[model samples]
Target: MLVPNDHVDQTGSQASAVRDADAVVRRCRERCDQTVAANEVTEAHWVARITAIAKDEDKSAFAEVFRHFAPRVKAFLIKSGADESLAEECMQDVMATLWQKAHMYDAARASVATWIFTIARNRKIDLIRKNARPEPEDLPWGPEEQPDQADVLALQQDSARLTDAIRQLPEKQRRLIERAYFGDLTHSEIAAETGLPLGTIKSRIRLALERLRHSMS
Candidate 1:
């Protein structure tokens, strides 16, 4: 028995749809494979650079790492609440540590970026804590007095305004700000947690910070 013309057309359309979907799947798989291979090559290249510095005291390799990572490390420090000057100083220290302790790197344990950023983070914290310590000249010579009530009231008002400003932020910006500040997560960590691109996470956080500063000001 012959099938109806409309039924034959419908069956052919279904087969075409299947073929199109299969092609799409193949393309996606190929792209994913390419991306994975590219990432592996990049990781190996960085590992080799660090190894060269460790084994041969390679200035060129160190330069390559510094040139690439200095800006990223500084940006990370700034995002973690350091001022520009402090970030610059900490970034320099981080690069110096990388050079002096290249032998300490373990490719099996962490990626080059992770190692470098970890150093930067620690250095930033150290510098901040050091600066926070009161100098001998800054110490009070007498018994401490109570804080002025007017000053306390002003501080509370400022805090309340800041809280209100944060609440007024767009949901996306507020969430990012909370994650970056209150949640104490780095941009890279936030990107990993949210499945966002690193650049995107940075952009959102930067925009959110600008908004907060403007609101506070």
Candidate 2:
């Protein structure tokens, strides 16, 4: 797409004027041949590919970046205390920002992964502050009306009911429930966050479900 005349940077080389980047990666890899395994592609290659996407809005390039980088972004968010849903949502937001800000990326200052990860980190912190409730800022999740309270579609109807049941669990159980299902933190990390012995955390989660089931009954 042509940028508006005012928006176009006529002074800069045409964005498409980027050099044939394929040879660049292959050439770099050949020198590091022994250090890099047969299956392993270096980050340099990924950066070249992503830079093309960033410049051109190339769907394939963006897809490649999403495939490799999305999970890493999500993992970073989860470690910083985002629940699973928030982590997943924020991962997408970060990737979207990357797409919009790709032109701003300069490999001279940072690696591609570092640039993307920094974007995710900043977004995660912004999300946390936005999600904070008030002075106490305690709540960590969003809310919804009951399944019966909506003009529910067939596909979402069952899920809504199931989630409502989960949402109604005790506060401690709800966090456990979220950690187990939503998957922001792994089992060990959850244990660390709650200051529970790993085994006890596991046990409580197991028991928490039994209670949830009975409550549904």
TM-scores of all predicted structures = 0.49, 0.44
Instruction: Residues 68-139, candidate 1: write the lDDT tens digits.
Output: 899988887777777899879878888999998777664433457767866775676667576543323321
Off by over 4 Å in 1: 1-32, 131-217
| Error at 75, model 1, angstroms | 0.7
The superposed Cα distance between candidate 2 and the true structure at residue 162, in angstroms, equals 46
Overall lDDT per candidate, in order of appearance = 0.55, 0.51
- Candidate 2 lDDT over 1-217, as tens digits, reads 2123332233433233222222333444444333332212233345455556755788887888899899988887786778899889989999999988776654433346657866876676566567632333222111221111011111122222233445556788667745553446576766434332234324433443444345446
Give lDDT for model 2.
0.51
Model 2 residue runs over 4 Å out of place are: 1-33, 36-41, 130-217
TM-score of 2: 0.44
